[model samples]
Target: MREVKGFNMTQTINVVDAMCGAGKTSWAIQHINENIGQNRKLAFGDSGEPMKYIYVTPFLNEVERIRQATDIDFFEPEVKGTKIKSFKALITLGKSVATTHELFKKLDLDILDAIEEKGYTLIMDEVASVLEQYDISKSDIKLLIDNGTIEIGENDKVIWLDDDYKGKFSDMKILAESDNLILQNGIAMFWTMNTRAFEAFDEVYVLTYMFDGQTQCKYYEANDIKFKKYSVEKSGDHYELIDYDPTIEPRKETYEKLNIYVDDESNKKKSPLNSNYDSREKLTNQQRSSQLSSTWFRKTATPRDLKQLNNNLRNYFRQVQPTENEYIFWTTISDFAPTLKNPKCKWNKSNDRTSDNFVALNARATNSYGNCTSMAYVYNRFINPMERNFFREYGIEVDQDKLAVSDLIQFLFRGCIRNDEPMNCYIPAERMRSLLKDWSEFKI
Candidate 1:
């Protein structure tokens, strides 16, 4: 491996920012197959070694897809006990493997040594969740500091002084050991991706849409990791990689198929629901936050408002645009999802799923909901305030509103529209609706 600091920035990074449903995965499959064939031809060369590959995606089904497509043996890390041991075994054996993003993120500092041993190309099916709002109460943070179990440095970087510690905060000890935990303003804790994880790869490819609007993109910028942009393009029968053209938007017709709900006297609700949320750029942060947000559904909305919103949800599924019993995809905060769930509209096609059609409001990188034609974006999208604050603390600027729209498009694309079919969406939040409209029309 080259000196970690000596790798050429451009040579190491390639981002395939194709529009959703543009076959980014297809292109990746083709790239891997070709690389394998080329490697085999050079088996007689001086090194006589085939380069290894590590493919990580958001779902297990996708891992299976790549593993099944090629003739090469792709190992799905089996837990003899823990995932870290299984994954390190695959890398240490120098095998081309496929795995889920969750397991990929669970990898520890020791795995880096195994990765650095060879030239492995890394293909990330979707940008991993590199930053998250760590759920630790303020009381816990204060207690840890007071007990001499932790120390805080500049940028509120949390250092775990208690390595041998195990118990209530064993999870904290594990994260600190990985060297990615951070405390924002000594209040909010976040688990950041250890950027050094990608250092040993010959090259890295991240496939997704609106890459600029993703938190991973900002995280990469903050880490000074430079990447080049590419997109999946269909030349004729097959998909291939090409320089990403912002002007070239494939399948715009599918976006035209969305029918956003607009409430009036004719609708079940006497007034427009969450209509005060429009002109989001002009609203104060607090004002913008309270409208159609998860917090609003949980705390801000009055009983009367909740009843009306619940009725509106039912109206959309039962009356406004009654389903043909196609899997109905809807989303809101998990706690309030039950109250707002339309009666008898929850489609249970599979017994395995806990919430058959209740996809998380911020979900992405899955095709499980592609069959869903009737989708309800019950909650408005908002950039987590901590997300914005984290970037700000690093003096890195991010466009929150742009990221909001980017998220909406990725989530909405999970519906039948992803299959290029018409979808009737119930997005009563005017601000989210407008954002979708503006983005669809290429005004973004």
Candidate 2:
């Protein structure tokens, strides 16, 4: 592992571009472990102490999984060593913690003070998810102005009242607001996420997965030039040459495509670069109606319906002890169901949710029975005979009865099903197993 340096009081934010399931948390853990191995102590205020690291994820389940992956007993309060914690609990205790972005936004002054006083490194996982959640509305700007945190001059130039104001300012208050906080307080942040996280920062590290399934990390500094350009504009039939700062406008660029074999093949088939899918098109009547129906179902799903669905699943599982392949299928269902159920899930940006929740659910169920090749193995072995025997014992006719397992799972989980293709149900079985294991203790 290469040593990640230059992150200190001066340089605060560093973004890492890595694919999902690319061992980002593992890399963070290894870095911390290396520090411990080297016996390096960090200073906090007047006291010379060991510096701590905080890993922040986007979800609670991610926190648990990351904690487990560390193979460290983190729950013991007395242990001054590293531990995983939610972003909400970072200020209170736990020297080294793992938390979500949702919890981090609610940080109080006391917590911020503690963080500043006691030196710590923040490793933000799934940064794109966090960034998507950060939206500065007009109301927020008004409140900030009222509170004197920010002030607009008579000339309309924005001024930050905070003591830690950096030279970088923007007409767009949201960018300025984010920059002001991150650049101040000597808080070093390490961000890791997929390509969707496109915010320009101090430094960026790109992690690429090779054709052989190995990951390589490369560091690059953004040297994109910013210069002012004058343009002519007509206002009320009067032509005027207007001087505009294009820096305030968002930079438009295509993401660098990685040359992973699978990605290359997929791109060849349906490249977004070659496609002309206009996302800004007005919604059709059918789409509008479908969206309304979905919204209605999501809002009006009763507790009784949810309870019934859960009962059905429990009963089904009780009747059939799944084979290894079937268990893998069940694992995917368990992992996906919760995410679909979660209203807070960033499904749109992440593109994790499929258009047809029902078809996706059925695809998973059918895949559990295994593909043709695996089905041949099941029949050749004693598993198929045993399953048939069990069905007979339960007085269930295999051909006579149709199981709407997918429909039940989808409706129970997401509260609605759409008439569309299940294109996004291709999760690897190993990843599904890990997710299922993490969600073992999770209720609902």
Candidate 3:
């Protein structure tokens, strides 16, 4: 590890290039371990906590291979009894532990697309072959090609040719193609065995086969060092030596700080204390108890939670108070009650506007739930729809009796106050205007 300050800028892609036996995968793994492990010291509390490597490969086989090589299992069940780190386990870790967050879900198609786009290290194997295969699939290939060159971007091009060809013409094609792309500042690739391709490569290698003797391998640069030797041995009667050079080094220092942990499968037993949330009804009960014990429910509360609770309450007030139908319901119930001491309510109405009694009742109903004139109107129209939608979207169940105006206000205005952390919830006076508009709509 050099005394480097660190690569202050984030790397979008780190390419570890090497042909066959250059140990690219091993080098890449070493790099990842070093960088991630180093990063552990720097990763402290923040909005988004640091996670161990979220290894993403193309297929399950590669995923499993990486997991085994790293001594990490990525496919264990998340139940308490499970010892392995499964996809389910990773998510559970995010939910329960403070240090962890989330693992990307492959099921999330959006994330899959993002992985292909803005990913850090693609960790591609046989990358040139992959690219070649991709180019051959016309359906997957670029929808457009410009002249003899396929324009990769507004200014870049990709050039390809047959591997077996060996003539001055092909050599000229390689030079022209390389120079043309280089002129446009583009990337290019050429097949092996064509030493004419050496014109385009930064480094070169020489491979030799031997009988009853050692094989010779040398790496060299065109203008700098000529060659350095490496050995090759054979298992069968026929032997071939494949050499590639400039010996692509892994992005070691960067990934050394990155420590990805792969644990053996866990097989723990589930316990009563950590039972899963069974149903929406159970979750509601849990939430109610949690809120009831929290300081927000107290008369003298901390400014933050109290403010949030009040804001939640205000939201409920804005969403659920009475309209004309409700006022009519209230009056009808009050009038139609069986007893005078405790008058129950009736809400039956036919939308008749002739008599002004119902109109007066509707008008006066604005002050039913709070001091503000429009509180009642805001409560009925706005809060109801929002609550229903939120529950439907998140699969949460609400208990109306246990719910308070402040709690509801906090819930409704949470998104507004999210970025405004360390601040108390403060309702604006102008909200009453919207409430009034809601009230006017309910006039019968």
Candidate 4:
């Protein structure tokens, strides 16, 4: 380990990128211990008081796991000299503390005050999840509220929302407000996860297990000495690595290629067939109807059928002298058929005539259309059915019916449009064309 003073800085950050079961947590503990030993002292706060080492994880289960492991190791007489303590114990003793990233959002003022007064190292486990939970934006809040997934209160505050929606929004708000305070206190942050969680950071260490089951570490720093290499070994639940060697070359082709697509214009490279396609071009009634139907299902319109429907819609709109009965019949079928595939007949009293749920349903339909672009990609990567199923498998109490509906709706909406306008009010001509293009390109 390098000198602690050399590594400790106001913006000191480190990311431990490794695969599951790669002993990242074990490696982090060992690294912290070595740094503490090298400094011959632990980190202190602005109050000049000794600060505690904090380990933050995404879940309570992880906190319990680390607590159990640390309790067993620290009690050994050989390791008794290490003055390690859990966040809970630290809080009870009125000392600096550690906690899960979720709990960090709900931390009381007193605990936060202590953290601001005393600098500490924050070891964040499952860094990817933490980043996702905390990366909240005002736009996300507005979307949830507008889509009826959440509701604001009289105080202009989010008082009632879906479980996941409420939690994510609250945590994002807290983290956004408090992160600067925590950082300004000169705390060091260590992140352990599979993916890079931040755009800017002080350093990053990648841990890879070779084919022979040996773990290799590659360190990247900001200054002139750009990289260093080391070999790591696991002893029980802890890890140890060889001294940094600048001469070591990275193993050739040892890294896995991730086929991740970014949702940015630059990354949305033009396909040869779509090179001339314009997202903003206005389409005729026939072209618009065909584009909208194309989003619903492939081969939805033969050229003949599309031309007939387009003509009917145009004639219905042109009927200024038509009876009220004829006007209602045509308009209702034109708007409702694409969504429910059933006409609003006079005999059906159960059918909703108002456009109360139209916007929401249209938003859902649009989302479903978008997801069909890459069904496999959306299903495996975006859906969380397994998480919900885990409760049922274990006989845990939950609103299974609600969960099922919510899950289905969420899956349908994944990567979908959130336009609040009802299909009856106006067809999203441009959006439909864009979705058609996306589906076409994906098929290609």
For all predicted structures, in order, the TM-scores are 0.89, 0.33, 0.21, 0.31
Better of 1 and 3 by TM-score: 1
lDDT of 3 at 55: 46
lDDT of 2: 0.31
Residue lDDT tens for model 4, 1-444: 111113223443343433233356678656655554232133352343443455665555555565565532221111233222233335445332334554543444445445433444555554212212123355655675577764544312233345455554464334323321111111111111211122112233433222111111111121112333445556786676665321232211111111112223676753322221223346566554334332322334344443443443333224322222222222122333343222221213345633312222212112223212111011101112332232223343343223222222222222311121111111123332233233223320
Root-mean-square deviation (CA) per prediction: 4.3, 22.3, 30.9, 20.2
Using TM-score as the measure, name the better of candidate 3 and candidate 4: 4
lDDT of 3 by residue, 94-149 (tens): 32111111122112322223322222222332211100111133422232242333
lDDT minimum window of 10 residues, candidate 4: 373-382
Order by lDDT, highest first: 1, 4, 2, 3
Compose the digit string of candidate 1's lDDT tens values, residues 52-96: 789998888888989999767889988688777888887888888
How well does candidate 2 match the true structure in TM-score terms? 0.33
Give candidate 4's TM-score: 0.31
RMSD of 2: 22.3
lDDT of 2 by residue, 1-444 (tens): 111222233332343322222233445556556555232233333234454655655556666776776644333212234322343254456356666555554443345546655555565653222212123455655766687767654323345676554433333333334332211111121121211122212222221111011111111111111212233333563433344322221111100111111122544653221111113246555432222122222543345433433343333224322212222122223233443332211123344433212223322101112221110000000112322332333343332111121122222122111212111121211222222222222210
C-alpha lDDT (0 to 100) for residue 269 of candidate 4? 58
